[model samples]
Target: MQFAQFDVAAFLNAHWQKRPLLIRNPWKAWANPLEPDELAGLACEEGVESRLITSGGKQGGGKLALERGPFAEERFGTLGKEPWTLLVQAVDHYVPDVAALIEPFRFVPDWRIDDVMVSYANDGGGVGPHFDQYDVFLIQGLGRRRWRVGPVCDAQTPLIPHEDLRLIEDFEATGDWVLEPGDILYVPPGFAHDGVAVGDDCMTYSVGFRAPSRAELAEAWTAHQVDAMAEDDRYGDPDLSLQAHPGEITAEALDRLHGMVLASLADRDAFARWFGHYNSLSKYAETDWRPEEQMEAEEVAAMLGEGHGLHRNPAHRFAFIAAGEGVLFFVDGVCRECRGEAAQLARDLCAGNEWSGSPSEEALALLAALINQGSLGFEEED
Candidate 1:
């Protein structure tokens, strides 16, 4: 499906941090990745996470049922019988088709791309009026849902029925619409909205945006930088003089300390590389297996020279190969060039797929070495 040619850059620059705008049928003849039956089956799986919430009384008052990860289908049976909704988070990473549905939106920064959450609802199923802290694009995939949204005026406004759900108290609808399959709704952070399923079954895909607070960024980056710093560089006073200003941290000293931390992340290439690696790492659990034995270098060289393809493990996010004078690695949000043949093999591994044919001899050799080192293993592709 071709997406609507909206000026995304302009919209992001203008309304991204400002207001909300709904775009109708953003994609042509939009199709859902998974069928209802497939979704139901997935909900029943032991490893798949699922939840059901029930609401009663009115549009604003409802009871919520909060469940954690790895839910089985039997758990949801007989629950949320009426006036309730079922929401499943991180559906994209599990379902390739759903992941593809969100790929077109990569025009937005990857860091801002959160998981695709699918919500299934029965007749009268609706989560009470509420506002989200992050921007989200709601696409109606099946059946119909009624949505109402209002502008946010305060950040500290108390919301949520329990510690888990954040429901708004007084939500004045600035807009009201019934979403049919293929219809889209864009709600910015703090816009209050309520959606009710109008029929027996309804599904909505929420493409959420990530809004990392300043504190969050600082915390993550600081830890990363500290780990990369050299040992024996701890803070200390070399010229100790007896003075009465023991509690005072001088501005110059504070500035120096800040510089030291910032210096670790100051290199543009380093920062990008780490961010890319961090972003690509899988958040889901990986299957376990033992590594394969190492192979001969000559055999590997022959295979690589034969143009054999190399592939990465679906569950492995970061892969590095030693190149000449440096190591080639992909991390955080960027890629880095490393020295030696190992780096070359790593690059080859990062680029290959099952369809790309067999791994080159050189790549095989390197993989064998990594396997021998217990750094990698072979897991059947899902």
Candidate 2:
């Protein structure tokens, strides 16, 4: 699913995060890759995050109604036919077809990607008018959905308080449109918007991005620095002048105490490496994605000799940053040092869906290690 007709530069310049933009049928021919039944089946699986939002006279008219799931098999059947939606998070981690939908959008840096969330709805159904703190591309996958965009919202904006959801209290639509299959709506962070199914069997594939807030970065990185500190790394002003007034702490002591924390914060190199490892952590990090039989160095060498290429797990996140004569490559939050051919191989693996090249023995060693960890897989090409 290549975006042959879309203009990447123009979109970035005019609208990347500036405002909302509507791209009508960007793909050559938009064939929806997942079925409603298939999506429903995914919702019923345990450990998969999912939710059902319902509204109408029978249940309740959009005031506050939501159900978290791994739902029962019969749950979908009981939702009636109107005003209900099922949303499944991180669908790309489980469905290859859904994962492929992310390929065209890789123009957005791979590291910044969060995950793909797919939602299905009956007529007149919506989660409600609300604004997200992260940017998202709402891609219409199955049927028509009437979408309305409102003014930009901020932290001071009022929200309808509910135990389960944060919905906009008063929404004033400034733009409205109906999206058919293949159409896409790009909304930036803090932009209020709502989408409702105009007809039955409406499906939307949302490719969301991560945006770390300032407070979050401060807290997380501070914690990382704190954990790295030595037990004896406490503030000490050894030049203790005889205190004229012991009850009042000296100004010099306060400055020395503050400098202790500032010293750690000033280490930009350490922060960079820590952030790279932190952000590369995958959503499926806790779950084992490794192979049952680990590959040995000899096996990997033989496979590469046989012209088999390496394929990364769709659930795995791979990235690299340039270091001295080599690059520090990351897989599922862990870093590996690779130089020369191995460094290039790391770049290649992260750039494309498949990796193939005449390998160095050193590169093969790293590949063998990755294969054993289940971060990458080797298979024969048909």
In the range 1-382, model 2's lDDT, one tens digit per residue, is 7675999999999998899999999898789989999999999998889999987555555464899999999988787765888999999988877888889988889988999999999899899999999889999999999999999999888999889988999999998999999999999999999999998989999999988889988999999998888999877768887989889878898888888879988888787777789888888667788889987888888887788878787788889888899888998888998889999999899898778676888988988888888788876456
What TM-score goes with each of the models? Answer: 0.72, 0.95
| Clashing residue pair totals per candidate (backbone < 3 A) | 33, 0
Q: Which candidate should be chosen as best, given TM-score against the real structure?
A: 2
* lDDT digits (tens) for residues 1-382 of candidate 1: 4586667888878777578777777675678767776776667666566776776535545566555645565755765455667777777746757766665666765546777889888888877788877888888999999898876846677675577777776777988999989888888887788888999679998988777777876687678888877898777667656666889877767877888777776876655555566665554545332254454656444544566543333333454534347665653223556445546555654544222334555445555554443334343345
Off by over 4 Å in 1: 4-10, 56-61, 69-81, 228-231, 236-270, 285-382
Candidate 2: C-alpha RMSD to true structure equals 1.8
lDDT of each: 0.67, 0.88
Please report how far candidate 2 places residue 344 from its true position, in Å: 0.8
